[model samples]
Target: MASPKRPIRIAGCSGAATDRRDAMRALAANCPNDPIDVIIGDWMSEANMTSRAASKTDNVGEAYEPTFLEALEPALPHIAKHGIKIAVNAGASDTELLHSVVTKMVASKGLKLKVAWISGDEVLPAVREAQKANASTFENIRTGEVLNSWKFEPIYAQAYLGGLGIASAFLRGADIVVCGRVSDASPVIGAAYWWHNWQRSNLDELANAFVAGHLIECSNYVCGGNFTGFKALETKGWENIGYPIAEISSSGGVVITKNKNSGGEVSVQTCSSQLLYEIQGPWYFNSDVTAILDELWFEQLSTDRVALRGVKSDLPPPTTKIGITAKGGYQAEMHWFLCGLDIDAKARMMETQIRLLLRPHAHRFTKLAFTKNGSAPDDPTNQNAATVDFRVFAQAPKEEDLMPQRFLRPCIDPIMQGYPGATPHLDWRQALPKPVYEYYVTLLPQADVQHKVHLASGETFAIPPPPQTKTYPAQQPCQAVTRGPADGGKWGRTVTGPLGWIVHARSGDKGSNCNVGFWVRHREEWDWLRTLLSVEKVQELLADEYAGKKIDRFELPNLHAVHFLLHDHLDRGVSCSSTYDFLGKNVAEFLRARHVQLPVRFLDRGRL
Candidate 1:
């Protein structure tokens, strides 16, 4: 029998394009004592993809993320000295350009690093061709709306690639692998696959690495960033929050930890928070393998170390997510403050006046909204505290329609006739029209993507689609588990307060949809939580945002969590969303702040 291979440690240095730039250097500096074999960085997201597409359309900047270069320059020496492999999907739309630049940087530094890049993620030509042949191929994944029904023309499209291309680059002796539009966890999956010489048949091991990759893909997220129990890190301080490292054994066991003596934490709760982030349902799908998250478990091994286990898997999905970007329109906003008494009445009067003024050219506007944020205190301490903000938001197909004269004039016309203490914030830039892009997310067949890897040895090879694939139902079949009751069972004594008193939550966006995952620290609480929080309950608690909107709910018993997906919740995502919580990061907090009946037994345990 073959000897068991040793475990490999992979560190995540970045979560997004805008994450802290010094994380790479920080992780590299600690590698002398605490060695890591590979460093993976995830730098793409729906929001940044829209921005990069627009930048490319207007020839204002490179389509790729420049921050990766900024972060890599400082850590190049340490990375070369330690001989650590690096993989990142920061290439965005221009992998070749980024590869060229990085190669030049390596040569300038006199380092012997061999850099390679993977491409074929850009599928604009294919998407356009499909649109001409059969538009149904571009059906929106969430809404089921066909692409022909969309108002704007898609200028750019990129399919989510798997990690096999990265693995191919590694096998070809490349020290650094740069990719474009690979799945967020692709870097980690590719690293693990290369380290263990995993084959396509190693479904469970790949799934283990997939989940581990998801957990640490966001860098400090598994190390206490975006955690609900942030107060727990008070002594350690949040300023220098540590990045996460995934230690994956040859047997498919995984342990999550951070740098020695670093700030923040790596507990089970922190791992659970990252696990539930931005997920759609119990089955976490990827191009290479589908992870069964319902049975996954996390255990605290020691301080700053948590073990993740029980993750199961099946064959890869036949299709992968693809995002197409188009110019939605131009948008502008105006803000007015309503102070002291009669806040609602003042807001109503201003809305009436603005609506009357805008009624003339309403047909030209695609979207118009009058929103009020906060309420004035009955008896306040200061003027600032007594003020509530009222906003007038407008979107139009043409920039001229959202210009200061067209959009802002109507808002300003009502000011003199407004209620007492109604004051305009008076920021001209806020009312000036700015271009916005709409991101349409759908699935593209894996076979349609021409996945290819360009090696440092001047050879290019195509990566075929996964040989084994499965087609799952649109909705995951319900599990056979049973719960207590919808009302959370009869606890004799109960108290009314915020749901957050005993619950910890994390929320994020998936295109225009928002997913909020809520979990408890104890098993007893999970019983009550699963029974109490229902689809109807969520609609009631978030009536303003979720009322009349479609919501999908699922339970992850192993993680002691319940998740909710709010469809069309963010007004078509960040670039065009008008809501204050545009990214949906605050949806969990919003639900937590809602008052609910809580059992005294759970409350007595103290707030999370």
Candidate 2:
């Protein structure tokens, strides 16, 4: 039986640009502590993206958007030390571009290059492609109409490349990795399984890594910063914030924690709060499986760690595939703040005054406003001071020019007409207009993404070659009489992993989700592999394997594929959900679980 206990470990790097020296200082801070296996640094920000793009620091050549390189520069050297492999998506427009700089840096320092570049994810063009693929079923997520019918073009289009490509790169020997436009959660996932060279089809393994990714994806949240209601921390010594880490196992378990001696509480509530933050929906995707949420559960580990498990796969749900944000058109506003004895009266006065002021301006305003949030219980018993503010605007072709000075007439009259002393309030101003772009993330089919890891600048190095290739296990090609539906006649192929080669045969309709996929296994381990399938060797696969699941199986004559419903295997059943979070998976245990006993003798290839 699996132990209920979990590990206490957390990992992260301080890459925030409060100061350049802070990177090294953050690095030095980690130096004194016992080392954890992983270090996650979250250095990208959407706000930073806009700001960097404005400064041309992102250097996309169009003089816009922040480049991954600019942001990573301050943090790279500190990462390189301690020999911790770094994962970051600072590649900006060019995924390949950052590798050159890294390779050069390694060469300059006489350090081995452990760099992997993951790519094939720029989704801007995909909007059109997705629109075309979906038959215009996708509207800009907000707008009721189809996007293809419109003339508006986005400034940038990029997909949230999950961790796969980068993880694959780590297998290629990258000490420092860079990515572009990958969702923030992906790097942590990439780090967990990439170095180990995990099989892509290991759903549970993928689930664990994906969960780990989610925890550290948001920097301080997993640490003490976002975790509220915790007991006293040495706030005086809390100048540096703790970064999160995960001690993951191969079977898909995650233990979340932070640096030791770091002041913060890690508990179920804190962990739960982090899990639910900012998620617009129940699903989050990694490269291999789209994890289902309903299968996930979490429990606190030690003081600083929390464990998660029971993650499973699920079908992508039906929803609008396009993202839409508001267009910043011309508009109008009023700005005022009130303070007086009766906070309620002060607020009411401000409200009535603004309403009266906007009587005529309302027609001219595109979006007029007075929002009362934050303060609750308007007629408060506290009798505390209260202040109300108002901002209204007049629409125009351009937001900046909307209403100009001509709209100030009403604002200027507060001195003589309203309150005698309030007449001085006429010297107020309107709220500034700013563009509010819409944001959205869609579930594009896996087929839409074509991943590639192009290895270049291959100068031979003094670094010891990983292991003897002779002992490296080779995958045995399935001597199958057939492979179904793959346009290519290539029925059998050998893929490499940390242990050795796995020869996999292609098949179709593996599940009833109306989709097709492939499975692979080690060539020499056919006996073991055969036992895993519903094929001839296993007698008949059990429905209980699906945990009380059911589904129809079909074989497509055109494809020569035998497809069966996994039942609840990964959400083939209508009752299951999509979305899997990580809690515990020891890097070792997760991999070992897959190496089950079988009739055939297993072989070891090389040291990972």
Candidate 3:
């Protein structure tokens, strides 16, 4: 069932919130008079996935992003015209449901598709099975704690089922491969490698296809939405975002481009930024075959096309990345306030009054803050009466715990305190905090992890075992925390524990492969931070913000500040990580349960 050996094409979209189907249809129609056999649409982020799942539970489809379904609506008609098959990860959390919707819609018109509806990657069902079997809750390899289920929210629930899954679906005579969620690059890699019959020995060749997939993975980020030059533009369209496409060659080289006469502009800078998104630093590790982008180059094929070349393979690492999802408890928040005229002055007065009001038990509160409606810039220039606000952070294991206190602490502000300049709203209490637990998960990089390529009819597509890197805990410390080895260049500094002051510094091109972040203190000051945020804690907050959405994976192990990999968290054959979905078992939490301490330490200032 394999096709010709020509290169495959793919694209990343550039609009703010464009439909995936629209972009895909445009892609098929605008394809450069070339024979394109496959197309991929990456539609879910970790947070978005969570949102999708939650919305489904609530029976309200209005809240979820409709790009995938909408895009499929029009795209199916267009692709059906030429028999161009497509594989996309845009079904949100309900792959079966998404498939049903697409199928019913297409069938309504008396059209039938040899469509393959697929599912099985989110760990929610696995969790139920494991718990039923009295199985061990897979732990995060980093920390040594069992997950608290209540706190877990699903961000994305895709399986890292390899390209073969989709190809096999296509080979079974299916026209479209509908996946709940898969790896970000696997779709492109699957489309290209499967068609060309590129096997495992062709790992290097597959690497080329993967690189092309990676390029267009970040949507408009690689084109112009995030262009830093700012002024160099004949035009820029943030509204009519352009989706990317890779005219991939079976030989591993590709021409990255977008739809014809698109709204956004493409250039070297845009594409370069995308090339750095969510990829492993040493190189992107794929089934032990590392696609080395360290020495990669991009050529301007035209106004919208870019050529990628010079990607070499690296010796594979020994550790297989263990994907584990575990239970964490739930967590929720409320923005209760204490406001008044001279609102800023009133807020400061209350902090003093409350500290005195609580008279010594003030420390009982977990989190309490007073500011100009937000965290610090401490800017005198931003002073405004209406712009002031205060926030309190609280938590408990139950909802009633918050219900009693809903009005317990809020209304007391207006009645208990006095501000000469204040007099307006009578409602100081809006709502109370509702408690939800957290799901703690982790990804473990270990040996013996299996990544199989499943053929369409349930056969195995064997791959030549690519190389992988394996290292002990170094008996020292991980550079991401303690100082890195002074190779004279790529070392990092991390800050931990309490300090008298705090400052935030972010470096590296946000568009670069590695966006570096660090904390700084004066040379004269002792290494102290007034407050320190654990990289994991920050990710938790990020998760909270993106509650119920599929999110990108964040690698805190290498970066000084635990840089976040923007987008590109879905694809095939890559480990179908379930960290983003509501995990009864989270891999990060799973690993820690095994009592394994990968690495954690104080920052070393030796190189500084």
Candidate lDDT values, in order: 0.88, 0.45, 0.47
Candidate 1: residue pairs that collide: none
Q: Residue 187 in model 3: shift from native, Å?
A: 0.9
Q: Which tens-of-lDDT digit does each residue in 1-608 have in candidate 1?
A: 11238788999999999899987887787788999889999999887888887877777889889999999999999899988889999988788989999999999999999999999889888787777778446789867788888878988888999999998888888999999899999898888888888898999999999999999999999999999999879898687898899999877789999977789999999999999999988888989999998888898998888999889999999989899999988988999999998888889999999899888777899999899998878799999899999999989999988877678898888777889976898786889999899999888888889999998878999999999899998876442233555444566588899999999999999888898999999888888888878888888899677647678888888889888888878778887888888889999998999999889998888887
TM-score of structure candidate 2: 0.61
Error of 3 at 182 (Å): 1.2
Candidate 3 TM-score, true structure as reference: 0.64
lDDT leader: 1
Q: What is the C-alpha RMSD of each candidate to the true structure, in Å?
A: 2.1, 18.8, 11.2
Winner on TM-score (1 vs 2): 1
- Give the candidates in order of lDDT, highest first: 1, 3, 2
| Residue 225 local lDDT, model 3 | 50
- Total clashing pairs for each candidate: 0, 45, 121
| Between candidates 1 and 2, the lDDT winner | 1
Stretches of model 1 off by over 4 angstroms after superposition: 1-4, 478-490
Write down the lDDT that model 2 would get. Answer: 0.45
